[model samples]
Target: MSADHAHALPAGVRPPTYHHFEDLAQQEESEKLGMWAFLITEVMFFGALFTAYTVYRNLYPEAFMDASSKLNWKLGAVNTLVLIVSSLTMALAIRAAQTGKYSQVIWQTVATMIFGATFLVVKYFEYMHKYHDGLMPGPTLFFTDVFGEHTPQARIFFSIYFAMTGLHAFHMVVGLGILTWVLIKARKRYFTPDRYLALENVGLYWHFVDLVWIFLFPMLYLLGAHYGLGH
Candidate 1:
């Protein structure tokens, strides 16, 4: 197609071609590769924390298990389901964008945002409970009293818990902002079936965040549940 014709195409119907790309497909491929590379960096970022947790957990298995029991698994499980549902909605939004269903895209994006907000609300309560119980990462009174013989080790477990979950929560907050932006753009019909690269990339990010929680829930909350390590 001529440059003028490509430029005149309705929003979302045709992908935009970048200066370096010979065609829209090439541009899209380049964008996808860039996003994947960024996600790889994100993986390494979280992987480091996972490594630290593994080393510490091994060093103090009993203390770690004991600290794990203090967390509210029921709430963690609920949040897991919420995030999973949000991921589903995000996927649906991307599909809608791909199909040129702008209305569906808006609704699905809004739904995903709602689910994400709900997850954060639940997380707020969980954190508040921890604060009230004096479970803030240091050698606090609750930590000392609850894990008298294992205070030092248990403190390490709580530290990891807060660090991991806090980082995850921060990502959720970022996802919320992304979804909100997507919602606004969808309302303006910014995405079209052939050119919803933004939606696709954001969906990939939301999915990655959700996937992280999947591993986190099992590791931080359910690992030793059968051994009475869950509250």
Candidate 2:
């Protein structure tokens, strides 16, 4: 390669060079490996929570089933669909970034954020319903009134419910922030066919968040659903 070509930024990539890597390919690989490592840690964190949930659930089977029945499955199902759609849009955004379709990248990223926000809004209503019904994690008269003798055991289920879903929601919020940043950079045309690591990395994170919710929905909302649980 010529001296000028070696020093010059790749076509469509803006200033602030990736200092640690010799070229775009190395940088991209490093970024991907870092993201995968972070995601693996996240998986372990969620796995521990799931293990605890399973243990408690098995120990208090009837109470857990009864508690699960109280959740609105319809809303959970709807949010699940919304998140899945967001993951699709995130993937599309990455594709657009790779193809240098800046306009499509912006639109797809915006769509993904909208879907993510929709999920949060639905989650808000769900939490509000639990609050009004006194189904929150702590002590409440509603549990006693509704579950009667099983109130203590029911609280344990709700505790795990809040911990898992609340953590997932927090990740969604973080993902939204990441997407917003990507949208801003994208508007500046800071990405190109050869250099769009930010978009790709954020896409992976968004998909990971969506995958967590996919598991959460089934575990928290659909367990023992055949036992006459209402939506």
C-alpha TM-score for every candidate: 0.91, 0.89
Residue 46 lDDT in candidate 1: 93
Q: What are the per-residue Cα lDDT tens digits for candidate 1 across 146-168?
A: 78888778888888899999999
**Where does candidate 1 stray beyond 4 Å?**
1-13, 138-143
Error of 1 at 131 (Å): 0.7
Candidate 2 lDDT over residue span 1-231, tens digit each: 123322443554553448877976776688799999999999999999999998998898888878888999999999999999999999998888777777788999999999999999999999999988988866563445677677788888888999999999999999999888998988876766666887888988999999998899988888769977674
TM-score, cand. 1 vs. native = 0.91
Could you tell me which 10 consecutive residues in candidate 2 have the lowest summed lDDT? Answer: 1-10
Instruction: State the C-alpha lDDT per candidate.
Output: 0.85, 0.85
lDDT of 2 at 4: 34
Q: For all candidates, what are the clash counts? A: 2, 0
Ten contiguous residues with the weakest lDDT in model 1: 1-10
lDDT at position 51, candidate 1: 99
